[model samples]
Target chain A: MTTLIAPVIPRSRLQRLRWTFADGGVIARGNLIHLVRNPSAILNLLLYPAVMVLLFGYVFGSAMNVAGGGDYREFLMPGMFAQTMTLGVMTTMIIVTNDAARGVTDRFRSMPISRSGVVLGRACADMVNSVLELAVLLGCGLAVGWSWHRGAGNALTALGLLLLLRFALIWVGIYLGLMLTPESASAAWMPLMPLTMLANTFVSPELMPGWMGAISEWNPLSATVAACRELFGNPGWGGDSWAAAHALPLAVAWPVALTLVFLPLSARRYRRLDR
Target chain B: MERMNSLAVVAEGVRKHYGGAPALDGFDLAVPEGTVCGLLGPNGAGKTTAVRVLTTLLRADAGRAVVAGFDVAARPAEVRYRIGLAGQNAAVDEILTGRENLEMWGRLYHLDAATARRRAGELLDRFGLAADAEKRVKHYSGGMRRRLDLAAAFVLAPSVLFLDEPTTGLDPRNRDEVWQAVRELAASGSTVLMTTQYLFEADQLAHQIAVIDAGRVIADGSPDELKSMVGGDQIDLVVRDAAGLAEAARVLAAAAGRDPVADPGARRLTAPVHDRIGALTEVVRELGERGIAVEDVALRRPTLDEVFLSLTGERTARAEEGGHGEEDRAA
Candidate 1:
């Protein structure tokens, strides 16, 4: 006990940031270690998108034609990227709920470490997983004759936008995970599939009925997909509708809006665990 | 630093409610430094709730508590920095290996990477989990997991430790192992506040026991003092003949200065007696004069189990119906 009584240094802003990252990194490492021990979950996540890409690009690509005279596989890659990133919400939700249910979150809360570290650590780990998922899907896209005709800078920017969308959705996952028990969080998986599929992930909204097209066009997932297509110079309708035309701004805005709503929500839920 | 503070934990009229029902109603306690205070109670007793509040996991709706010399509500981080809590459920991550679990906790406690690793190794060895340190916790048995959890708590050698029902589901052998570990912790001068449902556990480990029920401490004292509260030693006598039972009862009651409990089937009578030897001799003399044949007579002090039953029974009978039904089984 006496050995533990070291002087408490007054932390500067930079020091605090360093401490936060250090603590958050440790927690993130724990999350990553879980993934290593259970490689099946990561393999499933990686396999899900690859299979989706191959199935839609080869099986469905031959039949459907883009509004522009370009390959449908090229047109579908960006949408798959956006869809994979958004579906990360389910992965984050399940992991967070499991941690909370298993008392790991309580153990973290009881420690003297920063409260934000727990959430930030999960966010960081999920982002890393999202990056891996993107790489696997991109590899699958390349294997099926999909290429970004745009410059390297534009392609990288498109990847950046895809990851940004993932970053935003991770907050939503954290918020939902903390709000619901693990059993209820699994229920989120059902709604998420329809939510992503109803967007421009698998097919263009222009091909759908008028009313359904309008709804899909406004779907946040659609905005990121459209934005990625424009950056990658891939074939997309780029619908004349105002929402579709300004896809870049909406792609950024939707994630910002989601983070604004869910970050505080997740933080509040984490703090409320003490009560 | 005020290193010589006598009391490690102090609570004043702490109150907490879940929805409309009060979990802790005006609970008060004080535990001196370097001592093990066993909070003895039954299921649904506020033992877990009290430990949670004192450990800074939950806030009391009213009243105040100070643990490890820091106000629990006002300075929870400071309190957390000095204390360890192994909750009702084992809080270790099941996916991580036993060593990984402790090392993660150590890092969270702000120890450097090397120190954390070294401490994790030391704790695994201390808790006799060194061989299984590399195995994932999911594969660990209940006792092994519990030892790992306890080892995690000891990573910092905290000044104060709170263990809530640490051995609730353990078999006798595992329970004894935990008891040995707790004893070693106390011997090392770490104040321990453990909540337990087993009276014998408290008797074995606690220097002092606080019997709590209905969100309050119904009785608090040394084990012997609490037992004496229920009453002194009792003398039991069995007669040879059923026909002389009434005579034996009257003589025993007169000698003991109280009505003796009679079992007509066994022709036995039991009565509380302050002076064991004197009461025994007087009862034998009286029974002899009354021509009653006695088969067996012995005097024995009551066990802590009897003490706990008597104290909690009296409180539950008069308390409201709702307090005893809610299980505070939160992690």
Candidate 2:
């Protein structure tokens, strides 16, 4: 008689660690697979940044030059990296809003999973897409003779700063997405796009008049852009830049601040959603 | 993870009001462990409201509820950990694959990685969704999506499962598949609380049934017991003429102990009698004695629908589509 036997269980530290990380990995893998499967989103991420690069690189590239001492592409490249990463904020908002609108969030609420795992998993997964977007835009800048004179370590630091900003902004976008109904998420937050764009991402604050420049100079996006520039060894405008002062600290603080502000609000909203 | 032979779900004086209209007005239920309790109600009857409160999704304005030994209000997180809910709408994410949805829920339940994958595969196979596990949910058929949604809830082997109108728009075949799954869930020792507008579904699935109407329970009992409450038999006669209708009503009134009801224009007459066989024997003889030809004959115990009508003066499941439906618009 043939005896039935269970498969021998594998035993190893790596295997045990693999088993331990399996839940988070499955969740993360699920989110990544979703992004890969969505063709329209891929097209948007790939083509939109390329189009923006061609358009803005030509439109504003010749008209304005960096005040400090390098080519416009050099100065613009670091800021563009910061801008591209932040555009990922829109993707975060839309995903959250779409999920909430379609009752998917409600489903997660009823499930037995880690309470914050849903949102945290999405945020963590989206960071990869943001980095990819930044990397591509940076490559495009390189093709246009935009070079980072700063060493390899500084380049890594610049990317780190960009991720930090994206992380923080993702929470803000999530908060807005959770707060607004799906139908109105786009219309209600349309204003944030133009407002964030108006900052010192593309142009120098010194080029604009007093009041406009003041607001642009103080903008958090500007701080991120300026930090990237400093890391990249790009020339800086002479004014005592607030971005320079806030840069290093914000890499850590922004994400924490965003979490502190929005996490509780999202939690509260989640708690009362059934009511 | 196993529950003893105690109440799986219990609620006392549960009250919830939405925009000044009471959704669950002092509703109460006691569902034993490992049993399926069908919360039968019309569209505005507060079945969904009660499920929400018990699942810890909605907090009641007043009263108390416990699911799997955890208080829903004071210990919502613990309650959440013990119960699984499949809501009215299919809540699977369109952008994610069926496999992903289940895996995500598994992670939320804090299952380890290999176990989460194993659980996901098992549920996929159980729900007949293994073939479509990798496909985005947006492409799934309505029935398939519902199956996937239901599968996600089973990832944790939850002690108490709440299913709110789990098979609302499915065809007969698909509805039966869902019913079979629900039975399996209960058989696994999970306490199942389900709400449905389908009286036949309630009759087939519920170990104990509660008929909720106008935000309150009008009747509660086993299917057999509830049917017994309304009497053993009913004879409904539809005549060809209005005069015949009245004659039939008169015949039944005299034959039975109470006065029968007549819809003269519709030529319909209904009479409740003591015993199905005895009443039919007496009614036919009485009709022959009155020279009124019997157009039709029926002998059966009261259906859940009839029981609902007897207790609430209207069909219990019909309110979802009628004037009272506006009351559940927000719900």
User: Best candidate, lDDT-wise?
Assistant: 1
Write down the TM-score of every candidate: 0.83, 0.76
lDDT of 2 by residue, B44-83 (tens): 8899889888887788999988888878887776777677
* Local error of candidate 2 at residue B8 (angstroms): 1.6
What DockQ does candidate 1 have relative to the true complex?
A: 0.39
Classify candidate 2 by CAPRI docking class.
acceptable
Instruction: Name the regions of candidate 2 deviating beyond 4 angstroms.
Output: A1-23, A59-75, A101-112, A206-210, A234-256, A263-275, B1-5, B17-23, B43-45, B73-81, B93-122, B130-136, B213-215, B224-331
Candidate 1 falls in which docking quality class? acceptable
